[model samples]
Target chain A: MTARGGIDLGGTKIQAVVVGEDHEVLGQARRPTPTTGGPQDVADAMAGALGDAAEAAGVRTKALGGVGAGSPGIVDAGAGTVSGARNLPGWEGTFALGDALSRALGCRVALGNDVQVATDAEFALGVGRAYHSLLGVFWGTGVGGGIVLNDEPWLGRGAAGEIGHVVIERDGLRCPCGRRGCMEAYAGRGALEIRARKLEAKGEKTKLFKLMEEHDRPRLTSGIWARALDQGDKLATSLIDEAIAALGVGVASVVNVLDVEAVVLGGGMGVRFGEPFADRIREAMAPHLFSSDNPPVFEIAALGDLGGAIGAAMLVA
Target chain B: MTARGGIDLGGTKIQAVVVGEDHEVLGQARRPTPTTGGPQDVADAMAGALGDAAEAAGVRTKALGGVGAGSPGIVDAGAGTVSGARNLPGWEGTFALGDALSRALGCRVALGNDVQVATDAEFALGVGRAYHSLLGVFWGTGVGGGIVLNDEPWLGRGAAGEIGHVVIERDGLRCPCGRRGCMEAYAGRGALEIRARKLEAKGEKTKLFKLMEEHDRPRLTSGIWARALDQGDKLATSLIDEAIAALGVGVASVVNVLDVEAVVLGGGMGVRFGEPFADRIREAMAPHLFSSDNPPVFEIAALGDLGGAIGAAMLVA
Candidate 1:
């Protein structure tokens, strides 16, 4: 029985998993991402994680069929390098991640961006299983998305499906990408925090700041936001509403142009909010649809944290 | 020699052409559209136009291998019927246009929407020939567009490439399609004329009214607008600028999402303004592009008036 190795290399954490031919996870390992050691150090951590995962699965690294990794930022898949990943400190410029991983594991390796890999996973074995065309949106620190067309990922001119960068407002909020009015600038978790801070400064009644202070965290996590919403926090609710509306505009444009059959929501924020958030997005997107009578199906992603790893493995499967 | 028949059925005119396998025009005919006689009358006119074209080519209708027609409105290509064609009176609901034309011409028939067929023509033999992925935008009475991905038309779900309906402004201008903030609401010829009339009623100095009166036309034509712009009409220039800006936002969103290799501008307004309009669009779209450094090539569409006919023929070829 052949086994495949997969890694989801994120900003704060690196998750590695070994899966068999049936898509069942044979073994898994997790570790804090090394930010101080630069790209080489991060690559070494990935190698170690893969080794541990393979050992736990009772398989030799050299015996694995292939390995795949999903990272953050603009990835040149052909060159096997990642660039423009701002969240991963010391992880800039072109890094031959695939080559390094392949050398460490002694097998062929493939690479893709996190959102793209997650989308591929959803399309293959999750909520998007029934649709040939789909748009997968993941709301986390930044709102990112990927598109699958005719059972293949539509990577136009190297960098397609920048749904977060789609400008919803002409001259609205400033995005981290140096663009104004991008969907990310409005719907990202960072955006929500900014709004929360502003509303607190204005003396508006809210439990978000108090909760954050109690936890002693600089940024509110998806779990905290969910808890606040469940507790009926006014500021949190309003921020979520704003995010939903902005997300709706961007998603509606994608749906109207691509005419995809399904839109799957994933990532920390998306899965945390769950059905309520999906419903809001569907309702807000209805008015903007060109074909309002026949809109795409909106659903929450099903793969959970294993989506990126599963999707990455499938890249070489 | 084998020849194929093509027809462009518009609201005011019916154009038919016979072309050889090499895409050379063998024969062509044009006639005023029959509006009073209903869908059946329009079908008869299409048959008559094809007969005339085939006779001029000195070929029997039965000898032609295939015939294709491009019509206005929502077309069910599989069923060969057209619906929601508001321009053609009594052409609502569904008409079996392909069967009607096939019965009359004694050959297999194909059907597509006007914009989709025109885009196919441009992609296959015109400005978009060099690009594998393309977005073809046609500015006329309404702003309609078509997308070609991997050298094939992307008819998503049922109706894809509805770029005009992509909402740019939140609750902006009211669109004829009962939507707000659509690109067509601000950039279509009908939208431009509506703006002109409103400005004129506000006592603004403009050459649009003068040009319309001089030509004895109720509505301003593309040529009239072009001449007015050349003659230094402030109103016309401003309107064109506004239209270009709105078009840029909508187009930039598409480019940001799809990352097509090229964007070909065509139809009455696009051709009339030519390079100047294309330049303005490029400039306005730059700021909104996610990949601004490597933007898609913007070009004015070639193929002139025969684009629809040529594209239709290619559908069957």
Candidate 2:
């Protein structure tokens, strides 16, 4: 049976995987996202990543069944276009990402929202399989969410499950999206770094940036955060604490509305912090939850780093 | 051609109606809800109101096809019990509301959450007929919400659509439920009245209570608010403004997650304030909406005061 390829295009990195018919990963590849180019440059990197994954699987790109990608933007699946992917350089407008990738790889390509695809993967094959309804909270460069209702993904008017944008405090802080008091304003890694830099410039001491340079990394990836925590960096700890607090209120607000059966925490920060941080968030949710007695069961995503890629592949499957 | 009876059990009033097959109200009656009695008194009042409607419709209570009611609380449709209806005097635990009403009216009674059934009505026959997914925001004694997804009600874990409980601010004012920062903390009429009284006692100028007394209202009903607005009562206006602001953030947060196709505004204030307030809410949602360009259609509940009762009658239909 021919293998299928999946691509997870995120703000900081691109992950690609080749999977067999049983949804078992055969091979995978990762590449740094372009920080200076346009959508075309990102599309090229995606193609290259899939090519490497196919090579690792002992198959040719042309022989694959299909390829699917999870992109951070407004995905028009039928039109094969992506729009408003601001996290990517010079990609503030629509681009024919699907067509471009398909042409380069000599196969069909399907697209979906990055976080939503990861959520779908969890629901179909990971910890979410235990419940009929779930909320997937992906804490990465930016906080993202995916919602499942009655075992089906709920893409509300093409933009549902925007948990990151939910206001945690009324007009309290500025978000990366220029909005105020959104959960992402505090919890998203990108926002956290910005806050760190501003505070560091104002005389606060921290090893976050120094650690990034020591690791030869341009961005404060999850690894840098983990290292900072290991070193007991006070600034990093404070920002993370604030993030957890924001997530506690923000996530509880979502649960108060949907009252889903379970919650799965994934994404960079989620997977990095793991069960311990999940407990902290759940504890913080206590005071804000409307149904205090019947809280949703919380769990970390079981599929780990490859969850997004696998979920993307399901778009074609 | 048998008619059906429907009851809307609210915090301050009990409304009942007998409806024809076409969902047209054949007869209706309204009665003040008892503030001093327990669940039994509230149940008795519900039966008396239905009896008056049945009498006016020239049909015996037992001769009607069936009866349906919309009650506020944790409703167990399977067991026909309602629990935690705190707004009703002395009703803090499970009560066999369905069986009690059935025994009094000599008919089978079906029960549902007050807001959900009203939303069902709007989706089936009211302004919500235009959309496949809808969110019903009922602004009244307390802010209530009901959700419909893909033309079906989405009741997740038996307690979905608690839009009132969604936090609007971090560590904000205390809610009637004793929770902090909840939308209902600022917007619920019960909370509003309490604040008005507190401010009045603290020497704030307001004709709100005087207007309530002049209208012979046992509580500050929707009519009293409208009258106070017309008289330009500063305190009432200020309180209402705060409620609207809180609702703006709370409702937008829900929209950010659900992204339903339409929003139907019902309940006491919604119907009383009508189109203008709905517009105000729409404006308020602008800043907080994730997909601001593709906003949901907004409208006041078209069925007016009878929507909830009519929706309840549908339970038997």
Candidate 3:
């Protein structure tokens, strides 16, 4: 009957929430991630956020069942530390988030990849709840995926469902991770915007070009992409289709390896374009299904971005 | 101090061995696989082989810790059956190998996909024993891999590890599994033979062609390929390099996700080619490694094909 707290420490935003045993959110807070802060500063910021939520919910932080934080990058679950995160500005290796946060909140804490935490949240309380086996994919700044098997997180060597780095092209574009043709390099939101901007600079006749001209930026935003889609822009559709296909390859690979029941798409970009985008991914991935009779069903995350914070809380139970 | 029995069921041979608590092979028996027989007949033959091996080791089949089986195809471990297989002629859709064998031998039996069982065997008993994480790859008629995390197999859903079916290209080559651009489509031994035959038919000069002329067949066997490598055939080297590179993509993806310590290569092709092929895989996969400081170590399976049979025996334990 006690409550648990969850924190999602992302590159851009930090979200904290307190959830009851029934998985209902008691209180929540969000703020931008610290830019020039060390691990101590980041830990302090996380503590403040958690305290604010706890205070709003009228729950003592020490009385909470547990706390779970999902961060970006390689995390040592056993050590409960952020080993190395490249996306965030200064967290290079082995940030003792668990020890720091546990000390601050007076409870046990678990850490997971942010995308994986979102997936866990979805599997526990969102669209993935209906399926015993699910693959949760979040396509935002980078592509990330998590696998839930039999309603429990399947953390394989702390890397169960990393669909983003799955290679779709042998020698295609180089990725920051030093891999070529990874889905993250082609299907992530950043990739979509980069492609749109390239087309715009070349004076391409597409709705994306016009939107970029109006925004006066090299990259396209999710809203701009949605607007372009609304205008029936063929170029935007084509680029989105390519991104969906790439994402499909990564998802299908997971299906072939894991044979999960459903693939739930979350993150800012994954659910932004809505049902049409999900349909495109399903259509592209159908041919590569594990078996002819039964393939993975694709769905959108019900809790959306909040899934990560929810999953973080769910980790306690 | 209990002992277990393992069996590696291959098209040409059947190997049964008793492994002690320390993973040492106490006794082993090898026999030819009966090609002219029904499924039950083959099952009986395999049972007979194991019974003889157990007797030779002075252990009762029932008293043995466990029996494990490594065979080709989609295996349903829950039912201890081979659900479907492609390479083994008529072994399709749930053959009760575990049941029939257990009934005959009077012992509990565990069954798994051949590649997966071997991976387990290697992870527990071979080169992979040195690492907390590993991916075992067996390259032969088809390329298959199994994930080993902390010496345990990641048997997700009904699927274990079917890395061969991961599609690397969207529109490249058609696979027998009804997928396009799958890693197996380009790197499987069948594909290699097909590529070699096509090149020969197109008047490409190479030692492989010469060997084919000598054998009076258009197809090249593993032995022939070895001879070509010995002769320093440029075309053969190029083909081998290309195949290894493609296989590296799959391995790299696994490493990127699993962050495993080693990749153990088994099967005849992998073992016969040995360090040469393994070095190439390591080199090709290195650039795709996630960290510059450390990369997964690639090694030959010390247990060789015996890994399947050894892993099979450990199943009961």
Candidate 4:
């Protein structure tokens, strides 16, 4: 079984893995994403992460057959470029990310959208394996989504499955994408953090920021939220309630349109909150559902944090 | 050339068509749906309608290759049955509609969903021909949607494209389906009519009901709406404006999930108001769009009222 390398480029972390045939992880590494660098520096960090993984796997980086990476942005898979990844610092225009990675690692590099790869991994070898059609809802920095229809990815015009932007209200709260009334405006981690800070500035009593500071997190990380929930932070619970309501509307609305057999929830919050949160989202979806009698079942994505990197590795496979 | 018969069963009327090998309509007929009868009588009317069209085409109904039909409800295409068609009078349980029509007409029968067939027709020979992926939004008594992805219908779990049920608000207006804040709650003709009557009872001024009475229509049909708009009826225009706004959010929301290449607007309201209404909906969709830079284009369905029947005929073809 030949070894292949993979990378997952997120707003907070760069994850890398070296996998052998059958997708068993041979080695893995993780590094915090640079908060102040441009695309080139981000690309260098991704290369370094892969190199660390290759070293752990007892192989030279150049000895691996190829490497695959999942990155945020509007990806042109054919062109190996990423554009408009506003979540990354100074990632303004298109960058040949694949080429850059390949130059540093001495092999071909395949590029995919971050969430799409994670969804693909879940569909291929995780919770979505039993279903013919599945919608992978990854609730994280921005509530991203990916679709698999009839056992194939349905990337309509190359940009399908943008569920976070579904308008849950007409002209409501502003979204991170600059849109108003989007599901992400209410439910995305970035938006939630922004909302929390706004409320705190206006003298709203809350332990969310305090918890983040205690944990040394630059943002309201999922771990801090979990801690805040345990302490029964008023602001945290209230915002989480709103997020559940918005997610219910958004996810249920998608289920009504696609009617997939299953929904696999992933990403940061989805994994952290798990069964209880899924149950709440299900209860929320019940009212908005049109085909309530024959609704799709829900599952937490089974691959955990390494899903995107593993999926990218499979691109080489 | 060989001939085939097609039928479309609607809430108000039954439409039938006979087509040649080239799919050119050789004969057509229309009849009022029995507002009181069960599925058996409805099947009989469908048979009779096809007989008239076959006669007009100078062919015997039994001599045709086969006949196809588009009906509202959950269709079991393999079983040739329709179930829970609440739009039709007293159609509660499953009925072997294809078998009944086949027995009466002495030919094999094929069945499909009405909105789906209309969407298929548009994809095959109408406005959606140029599109690789399409979302057909048909706004009639109820807002219905049909989807085509990668040149095939995406009927996930047999009940996809229920776009009317997509929740647009958190616990907003109650829908006819007993849900709150559905797109159809605001945009459907039935909902709009209900809202208008409610407002009129509350002393809201408008000529909607007067125009409906003058036209001798039991319901506010599309023609009456066009006339009311021409007369600048405040109540009618206000309701229409709400519909446009709701359509914007609903359609944009669907586009966010699918990112389809095109959207084909059909059904009664969509056809009557045409391009101007489409433009208004487009403007409304702009703000809620996730992929604002590369949005799907919109168009009116080109097949008019006969689209469904023609689409059903193609099933036989």
Candidate 5:
């Protein structure tokens, strides 16, 4: 029986899973991502996690066919190098992630960005399975997207699925990517936080600040935003509404151009808000649709947190 | 000795061409479109033009393998029906153009919208041949677009290339399609004329009105616009600048998402403005590109006026 190892490498955590030939998750393990260590340390931690996961599944490392990983930032899949990854500090420049992982595991390793991997997983085994063409958008630190066409990721030219960078507002807001009025500038978590800070500076009272204080966290998580919304915080409600509107415009442009069959919303914010956010996007996107009668179906991603790990494993499988 | 017939059915005229197996245009014919007649009369005119073109090519109707037509408006290619074609006043709703033309010509009839057919022509024999993924945009009475991926048109779902309807401005000008701030609402010929009229009403000195008076025409043609721009007409320069900016934004959004290898600019306006227009669009699009270093190449469609006819013929060939 053949099995595959998958790793999801994020800023905060590294998740590893062993998937059997039957596509069942046999075992999984996770560890806090080491920020103090360099790229080699992170790679070693990933390798250790993979071993623990395979051992937990009662499978020998030598028996595994291959391993795959989903990492943050710009990924050169062909060269197996990662760059521009802010989350993995000091992991900048061209790092041979695939080669390093392959050497560690003694097997071939495939790598893709986290969003693309998650999208592949959803397309193969989650809500996107029934659709021929799908666009998966994950709204976390920044808005990232992946395209699945004919059950394969449509990597146009070299870099495709930069939906977040697409301009939604002309000269509206400055994006971290050095562009003005991009979808990410309006809808990304960073953008939401910027608005929250501005509102707080203007003497606007909100439960978000209070919740963050209680949690003793410097950054506001999706959970904090969701709790504030639940508590009827005006600032949180307005920020979310603005984000949803921007996302709607960006998504509408994509649908108008590509006319994909379905769209899956994922990431921390997307998963937390769930159907309500999906419903708002659907409503806002309706006006811009050319094929309004036969519009694409909108759904929240069903795979939850395991999507990246499952998708990475499937890449090698 | 195989020959194919092609027809370009537009609001003002019908262009027909006969092409030999070597992709050479053997003969062609054109006639004024019948505005006073019903759908059948227009169909008869198209069939007559095809006969004339075949005869001019020194080939009998029986020698022609098949016929294809590129028409205006929303086309249901499978059903060979055209709908929402405002240019053809009485040809609204579903018109079985393919069945009618097929019966009249006594051969198979393939039908597509004008932009799609033109894109096919450009992709097959013109500037887009070298690229794997291509986007063809046409600026005429209204903005229109088509996509060619891997040398085949990417007709998404049922209606693929509605680039004109993509919103560039929120709550801006109203489009003929009952939408606000669509690319067409800003860049289309009608949109430009509206701006020209408003500028004239504000007592702006312009040669456009004078030229229109000299030509004694109610509508401004691409030729007139070009002449006005050449003569340094203030209104014409300003209006064209605005159109270029709007087009740049729309195209940038498309590039950021799809990241096609090349973009082919066609239609009357696209052809007339030529390199200067292409240059402006390229410069304006540079800021919005996610991959600015390796942006998609922009080129004017090389097939000239016969692109529609040739593409239509190739559809059957």
Candidate 6:
């Protein structure tokens, strides 16, 4: 039986997986990303990870059908290169990423944006396969999204899925990308942390104050907020509501324009918030939809943390 | 030389043009739309106008290559039919509009949404041809836009251009489409008129007060507002600025998402405000762009009101 491979070269971690043709995980390995590595070193680390996974699984690299890697930033799919990725720092200006990875794994490699790779995993094995089209939005430290049309990722010019950077507010707050009122600026984890810190500095009464006391510098987690809400804290609940509202607004805009069937909310935040958060987002985003009552059914990611790994594996499959 | 025919079925007027294979207009004709007429009656009137133009140019029906009609609604380009149109009431459920017109003119016909057709025109022959891709925005009673990719209109799903319905504000202003805070609700001319009437009824001080007195009811117009602004009316200037800012924000969202090469502004209002308004929008939209200065250029339509007609001709050509 043929085996497929997946490689996820993220900002903080590197993961690779070897899977059977049925998508069952045969072997998997992960490690922290190299802090001082150049693009070549990063590529070599990715190659080593793939080798370890394949060796553990006793899978022949030549038997692999496809290899898909999820890297950061603007990926030019046609040129098989990373055009620009700010998060990775070293990978910029059209690195022949796919070629390098293909040579390393001795298989055809399809390089995609990290978020898009995550979406691909969702489409292949998550709740997305049933739908004709899906918009997967990942709300984490930074917000990122990807679109899957008919089981294939729609990589528009520059492999763009910058749904997070889409401006939601006309004259709202500034974003890290030097834009004002982008969805990321308001709804990203960073934005939520900033809001929470401001409230704390103002001496507001809340469980978040206690949550901050428990953890150094608040850690600023969506998971922490979800826990606070579960414990029935009003301030935390309001913050969750605000986050959902902002995200819902962004999701609604994408649904109205794209006419997708389902919107799968992935990433650490989405997984931590669980189905209840998904429900709140679904309700919040419903009124703004152009389609029928059944518009886009919001769903949590089926793969969870292994979404990038699973999706990356499928890239090879 | 064979001639290609083009028709623009607007709400109030029907415009037709006879063009050569090179897209040069051989002859053109325009007539008021029969509001009380049925489908066949309207088709006959449009065919008569086309025939008049064709005859004036000494071209026979046999010498014509094909005919293209650009109307307002969800045009099924594959089937050459307009399924449903809100502007043209009762025109719903897959009317073979192109077939009807083709039979009337004894020639083959192609169909497209009016805004998309105009966008195609700009992409094919107008200023947009200089660029590989663009976003064509038509600001009429309601705003509509089209995406031109690789010199052809990229009509996703049903209709080609529905940029007006893109939600700018979630749960803000009530849109006529039963949505909230769509670009159409706040920036459309219809929305502007609605706002002007409400303000006038409350006795707001402005030059529009005097203009409304000249007309029986308060009517908002780009011309009237231009004239009022020329006379140093602060209200008119502010309203225009407000509308332009909203449009800029919307266009910024589009540019950041699509990353098109240029944005061509057309229709009645777009041409009226000219380059000054276009410049302001370009400046406002730039900050939210993905590639900074590498974002789309702002351009005015060179075909004027004939953009749709010219684009229709290119469709068949």
lDDT of 6 by residue, B1-317 (tens): 47899888765467789998678889988875555646666677778878888987788765689888887766778887775565454565557788788888888888877888888888878888788768898886678888776555565454434677766766668776667778878777767767766776887767875775675333465666677778888767777787787788777776666667788998768878888888987887777776674776789998887888888877788
Q: Write down the C-alpha DockQ for each prediction.
A: 0.70, 0.85, 0.41, 0.88, 0.66, 0.34
lDDT per residue (tens digit) for residues A130-159 in model 6:
886788988876678887754557655553
Question: Where does candidate 6 clash, by residue pair?
Answer: A6-A312, A6-A313, A66-A316, A67-A316
Cα-based TM-score, every candidate: 0.89, 0.98, 0.81, 0.96, 0.90, 0.81
Clashing pairs in 1: none
Full candidate order by lDDT, most accurate first? 2, 4, 1, 5, 3, 6
Q: Better model by lDDT, 1 or 6?
A: 1
lDDT score at residue A98, model 1, on the 0-100 scale: 86
Please give, for residues A5-70, the per-residue lDDT of candidate 1 as tens digits: 899886546778999997789998877677575777888898899899899999988899999999
Deviation of model 5 at A220, angstroms = 2.4
Please give the lDDT score at residue A54 for candidate 4: 93
TM-scores of chain A across the candidates, in order, are 0.87, 0.98, 0.82, 0.96, 0.87, 0.78
Per residue, candidate 5 scores C-alpha lDDT tens digits across A135-239 of 998887678889987666877885778898877776778886778888888888867787788889999988898898897655677878999999999989988
What is the C-alpha interface RMSD of model 6?
2.6
B1-317 per-residue lDDT for model 1 (tens digits):
47998998865467788999887888888776774867778888988888898999988878997988998778989988988776576876888988988998899899988888999999989998898999999887678888999998999987889888887876788886778888888898877887889889999999988998898655677878988998999999998888998998889988988999999998778877888778999998999998888999999988866787888888788
Docking class of 3: acceptable
Question: What does DockQ come to for candidate 6?
Answer: 0.34
What DockQ was computed for model 5? Answer: 0.66
Give each model's whole-structure lDDT: 0.85, 0.92, 0.76, 0.90, 0.84, 0.75
Candidate 3 is scored at a TM of: 0.81
Q: By lDDT, is 4 or 6 better?
A: 4
Compare the candidates by lDDT and give the number of the best one. 2
Write the residue-wise lDDT of candidate 2 on A13-130 in tens digits: 8999999998899999999889897999999999999999999998998888999999998999999999999789899999999999999999999999999999999999999998
On residues B1-317, what C-alpha lDDT tens digit does candidate 2 reach at each position? Answer: 68999999988789999999999999999999899979999999999999999999999999999999999999999899999998899999999999999999998999999999999999999998889999999998899999999999988888899999988888899899999989998998899999999999999999999999988989999889889999999999999888888888989989999999998989988898887877888888889998988988888999988899999999999
